[model samples]
Target: METLEAADMTQLLMESHELSTMINQSREVSDYLSAKRQMEADVEAQRLLALFEKKKEQYEDVQRFGKYHPDYNHISKEVRELKRTIELLDSVQAFKRAEDSLDELLYQVSRTIANAVSGTIKVPSNNPFLEAQSSGCGTGGSCGCSVKKPS
Candidate 1:
């Protein structure tokens, strides 16, 4: 019976360890998804940047001409193009931030799940996680953890 008990403990520990590994692997998947999303967003961003760079000289020319010829029409279009580029860049930044937030949230959730399974942490009551440790009774008597308490 002692051997059987040891085997059960070994199996439980192995399963917990595997679950931890899977959680870590899923975090990597989130990272990969973020990278792919960023790559797609970059295309539009770079196009806008390129437009700004390519037209800068033209805009500068119109600015210099409009100083002498106050009724210049080309200057207005150049200004509008600059605004369009700004809007595109802003859109890219927003997409990147959304992707980053998704990755961060996924990582936090995976870590929480991994800790719950392997750390033997007692789950908090509904609506009580905020103050869970405030009324602690120390470690519960039957903590699944096998670690010895400090002497």
Candidate 2:
């Protein structure tokens, strides 16, 4: 039984590696990489991204220590505006779309694998992955949906 389990694990790993390779070679991934490179090379985008990161860090720090800072609201607004502006860029928009596509692909693959392992598991027909992608509520937090616990 141990040897059989080992063989099954090895097979699963090999298949997972193949799937990863396929995902990497996909157009969405290629586009995402290209857009990322372009964004990195843009001076203005870099400046905006740096500013956003700095403000985000400050906000997180304030929240973490349970301190009320008068600048919190201002920082939050600035972050949102910066993000909106960044998203308006063609390269950034392309990167976002590619990222969402890749995310959905990965989520679907994971769900399929889980369902295969546990035949009793059933996912609703609403395409939760795509819904989450579109809603832009990644992983968790205020999505009005219960978070799934890992088994």
> Highest lDDT among the candidates is held by which one?
2
lDDT (Cα, tens digit) per residue for candidate 1, span 5-28: 334888879987886677556745
Q: Which 10-residue span in candidate 2 carries the lowest summed lDDT?
A: 130-139
Q: Any residue pairs clashing in model 2, and if so which?
A: none
- What clash count goes with each model? 0, 0
* The candidate that achieves the highest TM-score relative to the unseen native structure: 2
For every candidate, C-alpha RMSD to the true structure in Å = 15.3, 7.3
Q: After superposition, how far is residue 33 of candidate 2 from its true place, in Å?
A: 1.5
In model 1, where do residues sit more than 4 Å from their true spots?
Answer: 1-41, 67-71, 85-151
Candidate lDDT (C-alpha), each: 0.57, 0.69
TM-score of 2: 0.65
Q: What TM-scores do the predictions have?
A: 0.29, 0.65
Error of 2 at 72 (Å): 3.2
